[model samples]
Target: MKEKLGVVPFWQGYDRKEVLKIARIAEDLGYESIWIPEAWGYEQFQLLTEIAKETTRIKLATGIANVFSRSAGLLAMSTATLDEISEGRVILGLGTSGKNVVENFHGTPYRKPLTRLRETIGICKTLWRGERLTPEQSTLAELRHFKLAMTPVRADIPIYVASLQPKAVRELGRIADGWVPTFWPYEHFNEGLEWIAEGARDAGRDPSEIELAPFLGVVPIEDVDFARSALKPMISFYIGGMGTYYHDMFCRFGFTENADLVRDLYVAGNKQESIAAVSDDLVDAIAICGSPEHCRERLGEWRANGMGHGLVGLSPGATADSVEFILKAVAPA
Candidate 1:
């Protein structure tokens, strides 16, 4: 809840103007960074470019720019350009979006996620270091001889991977500069970190070198019931319709019964029931909601659990004023 917290004002419900307003306010309020997300709405780079021109200080990140959307070399060039334009304030956050988005939306085959991620990172890093792409390292033949025409502001842009599965999380620590975990409850936060550390140690890297930046959903309201209810729909969507990968992860995260129930009800078209089944404890486990005081205490607990930097999502029904209040309440002392 310190200045280590970043703001991820996802552009799902908000318009462009409103998104800019939030970003500007977050920067002014001493937030560490502004993480833009790319699901299906707006392209992350264009929005990031606009934010770069509008703000001078806050660092910019993708929250997660889907790996399936573009080739590794192209991602490298785009990130390099963004870093240059943002004056070296860019963190490349990459994720293998769910099959629904990958196969359906992007029309790309969803196979070899681990290989794709590994190869992408290798290719991007090689290109960023001003080296030509090698055929063996990249799946894209077009990038075989391509070199970035423009010099990048920083050769080493921090790469953060958004992962929840154990194998993916392990690989993240072994190679990525940071991690962006979702639905990561504080109770098992240490357990997740241990997986990452094991991978880091196996790779001969210090575990501390790996940054822990979780994406948390926060709903600030005095009425705990309303706050919990407001968060249920989003939670249901991710756990129910998102995919089996996440459902399995939630099970592993110690929510096996709840996850199974939610999935059953949700898939059976009992949407409201699924939402209703999201227990208060489950909601509280992954998110911070309640009065300002309660939220502060929860964030303190999160900070104590070794939250370094984070990206927080202000839940849907919350006003801009509510977000501002929480911002001040949790700002670094």
Candidate 2:
């Protein structure tokens, strides 16, 4: 399939005015969707609402909002509200965030990610259908016997699940309208797709109906050295220090064999060494960092691997003009 291309805005340093300008420009650029993220600094829903009002046709999505942070019912209400504001162009992306963010930042327990995700999705679907919710003893218990006072403008809002593990990916296929993921290498896409298909069959849902959208880190530059250098910080941060021993994505990717060495280098502030520890093959496999033509080949591989949407995360110092250039160069003609 010829897939849609999208952009993810780094809403951190921008004021409201700047964000609106970016959103408007993205819409004008013929982009299919714009993903807004929530973290400690910014509110995802508020930013999305503003962007929805500013743009005419582009879709708006929460790149991901943590399932543990809010009550499932409240999340459904927020999703419905955003959908109404965007006139049914909202995609609710939900995830079980890592322990560092969920526990330390949000002051919520990070436990039973699979079960929590299942319950949260179930409750959100129920609430979206205008069903009265009575909280059970699952991860979702903050809102009990609550129903939205106002009626939703639409009940067909798409719910995308942000997942990294096989289990969650499969569960997402079973229940979610779409999948959002990170750190997925093009070569391993089928490893995930197979699990997702299993879940879809288990739930009696068509696997093809589930949209697969994965974020790709791209630095479109002819200067290979510069592009490689720019990706170092992110590589070191995620591969070295993003999570605890029990739940690190990097370790699962085989970087754990050098765990102490990697962490020590990262924590002692030798970021370059930490980046060096990340294998060149792994980095090249996962990220699309090269000239425009090279990026097109990489994107083609991802598309062949079952991805339906490319969510590009442009690196720092990468201008919107550069992004637009790359998009036009690689987008299907």
Candidate 3:
């Protein structure tokens, strides 16, 4: 059986043309989607629009749009316009990025994230519904009372929320049509599903209604050691200094010792040490690496274990040949 897979290219440090090539390749290979992430790098809308022009069938999404950066109504407008351009193949992946990006980079305070996200989705839907966004509804983002100037071509576009914390996951279950989780090892995937189910039950929504799409880092290199080493920096970065939120989440997922050591090494300016400290076991559990056969086997396991939709994050060292190999190996039938 073919598993659902989406390509998530490294947005920064790569040539724009190459990224577009990967998207076209994935579409040609029958991958389900291509997700573009916005993280202190390129804007997603322009890039996604450009990508839409290149690919014919694969769905496009904002691996995530930071809720703190743009108002909810604007997000709705952007999604509507992109959906129109993509001919209704756009998925709005929304999230509250770490405090560092929100406060430091965007100059916006990250406040009441759970409520903010819930309200943001509601506001977006309200605008899409062509209803008047009243001041009473505007209390969250200070949204003004107004209706969309034009009717959206597809008002019911899917909205997926990127979440890790239990509360956020629960809320995602309640409101989002899908969930995008990072650092979710296969062993702990069910834990997140349960949290989402709890919220679905609370809201009287079917748990199956929400799609489970996890971001997976894949390193398909001939040398096992090289693949593991290549992924260590990224794994260590997220488990260490990305933010206390992610660090705490990793600890809760039963990586307390590794998380602590990685964070300590990273903070002490021992960046190399931090990378070295990321054990092969942790990396293997969270990512797929090694030979092509091994990576294909893991992809099968992921599909069997409820990976309905997967966002594949390629290693920085991935070449054109390696990416094409992955596309064929994991292509959805």
Candidate 4:
């Protein structure tokens, strides 16, 4: 059985051409999709357009474009354009990417985030339905209710929401087509699923309608030693630097000591210590990075537990050869 496993490129600090090579290789290996993530310097839609030029079968996603930065209408518009370019294989992955990113980076206040999330999804769906986006829906008095000027490739493009908190998880379950959770520990997997089920039941929607697709930091490397520490630096940075969310969540995942130490070490500029402090238990809670056989085994765990895996490049070693080997090793079929 093909598992429909997807992959995320090492978005930053890698050669652009190389990322495209990863996408092409994933396509060739029959992976399900390539998730593109936007950061300080990169535009996700532009990258997806380039990836579209390179391959035809694999699906594309924003991996997550935060809900705070862009208006829902604009997100809908840009996503629609990408879907058209990709010939109707685009998933708009939305997230409330912490307060620091929203206020410090985007200069947008991260206020009423879940409310904003609900409104955003409603507006996006409304505009895609060729209906006017009322100011009541958008809360922008200046911008009148407007329908998309151009016809979208698919009026109902699949939407996935990256959520970590209970409220956000339940919210996405209530509305989103898929749940793209990050740092979702494997232990409480059924706990998370139940939250979604509760939400679906409350909303009178079928729980199975919402896809349980968790993000995994999978990076297959040849060197036994390096492979062991593959995702440490990136994972440490996220736990410490991104915001308090990850740290708190890790604590909730029963890794309080490790999470605290990693955060303190990373924040205090003890980079090596912080990375070293990322315990194997914490890492294994969310990532699968090792040899091909090892990755296949760990990925099997995720799939058997009833969730699709989105392999985010936890290790920056997703070079041409490694991408090919790992994709083939973890091929859905």
Candidate 5:
């Protein structure tokens, strides 16, 4: 594996205080960036602010801040502020988070997700350039006339779109500075590459304009079975309980029976069975687990198939010391 890795330490069983420590260690180990996720836990930018205060070299990304939770103006302002504070080390990774999270958690309707994402991107860029929002772009008549007061540190802050569906995935070719995807099956993954190229051609943009930066889950323990055990529950949760997207994706990847069983068992409240339903083969296709050597080999496989930067999140049950060891063992060579 080459040196194209980024660290994301917001997985289950991770100690909150240890996140900054890991970020510092990763920067020292020559990792490219650190991506902080915002779901139900700590706010993404605040955590990145702390990391920005602690480390100086590595880039900082939002991992994903969804479009629905915050208005486009707010997202632009906060990201601009963070970009200034971080001294131009910000990558605003945007996504349409699941319907449950947007509606149930944020109390916002999840209609027209792709449209909101496209609108949010356009608005954020417009504000970043110190330009007023146009009448057609704003939902409110009053919203169109105001521009950001302070100049952003960088006008073109990199925006990575983390989209799963084909329609939004196609949009990535036209607009994204980087593509942040997870759970794209290793085999037959070229299906997505074709879509990206098709999108670029449609938009009269070269596909090379978009960077390939996908997420890959990893369990760095030496025991393959133990690592699989740790990874299965998370996979099951995403495939079954999280939403229909993951299940539909796996089905699209030719795992219809497996995906169906996992969802059915999970919906029936048989979590253990749902976890058990996740096969080791599927895990291998989607993640890198097992011994350090095995992880290194699996990473090489993905890179061989066109994975660029590796934004790896260790599986649950990783400790500070264990993470340090894993980082060293699997550090890009």
Candidate 6:
């Protein structure tokens, strides 16, 4: 079966107008969804709100809003507000973003990501259902004694969990409306899905009911070396400095033994060495590169692995025109 494809804005330094233009184009091209990520620049909610207004059909999702950065109630409120604005076309993608972002950026300790995610989802669901909430201290306890003063336009907003580890992905299957994993190779998803299915069965829910949304870097260049060059900085950043001991996904990719060495090499300004360290097999597995036809084949692999939503993280140099061209070339009519 042919699968639907979406797009994620890298959100470099584009102004709001440029961002909205991209959104309009994505919508025009029939992209399934448009995701806005939160990190260094503009706030996710604000950008999503603008995109929601600019486009009418495409779904708007927070590629991820870190759970540690906002209180459960506040996060719930944000999701509720966005849902209202978008008229129920919002997918709240939540995550326990690494210790780097949590501690360094949000000034919060990154402890018990699993517990935090569970509580945040529970609280958000309750708020969306218009249940009253009472302030609670524990991560697992439910406080649905207080209700939102304003009525929610729609009570059912999908919540997708952004997880990299196996345990978290399983937890997402148990409770979240969808799964959002990054840098996962299509071939490796079966193992991850097994964990998710286990979680679903434990919760007495069917695993197939939960949505699977995977995002990965896509550089659709004909020249293999040029594509590799374009992807080097991104690979270097994640494999090197995205996290310290606690927050790197490279370890999960079987680089556990050489993670520190890779990080040190990457940090010491040895970018070429760092990229060299990233095995060609690793790059081929996680990223969709090469010609348009090769990218379509990769997309087919992701679909066969049970991904319901495919969010394309377009390369930095891919212009909107180029992106549209690539999407048309790969996506089913």
If scored against the real structure, what TM-score would every candidate get? 0.94, 0.89, 0.95, 0.93, 0.94, 0.90
Clashing pairs in 1: none
lDDT (tens digit, per residue) of candidate 2 on 204-247:
99999998898877766688667766666676776567665322
lDDT of 6 by residue, 1-333 (tens): 446677887756545665677778877877788888888678999889988988888888998888888988888788788888988888888988888778987888888888989988877778788876665735454555766777777787888988877788888888988888877767778877888899999999999988888887777768876776666667667767766532256566565655566677888999778766665566677777789788778777778878888888866534666667666666544
TM-score pick, better of 1 and 6: 1
Q: Rank the candidates by TM-score, best first.
A: 3, 5, 1, 4, 6, 2
Cα miss at 71, model 4 (Å)? 1.3
lDDT of every predicted structure (CA atoms): 0.84, 0.76, 0.84, 0.81, 0.85, 0.77
Residue 301, model 2: lDDT of 80
Q: Model 1 over residues 1-333: C-alpha lDDT tens digits?
A: 344889887556756666677778888888889888888888999999999999998999998988888988789989999999999999999998878889988999988887789889988888889888767775544455777887788889999999888898999878899988888887788987898999999999998988889988776678999978988998998888988876887788788999999999999999999999988888988889888788878888887786788678865434566578767766654
lDDT of 3 at 196: 92
Give the lDDT of residue 8 in candidate 3.
85
Query: lDDT at 34 for candidate 2?
Result: 84
What local lDDT score does residue 83 receive in model 2, on the 0 to 100 scale?
89
RMSD of each: 1.9, 2.7, 1.7, 2.0, 1.9, 2.6
Residue-level lDDT tens digits of model 5 in 222-301: 88888888778888998888778899999988889999999999999999999999998898888888888888888888
TM-score of 6: 0.90
Residue-level lDDT tens digits of model 3 in 211-312: 889898887767889888988998888876777876787788788898899999998899999999998888887888877778888887877767789899
Better of 1 and 5 by lDDT: 5
- For model 5, what is the alpha-carbon lDDT of residue 104? 92
- Residue pairs clashing in model 2 are none
Ten contiguous residues minimizing lDDT sum, candidate 2: 242-251
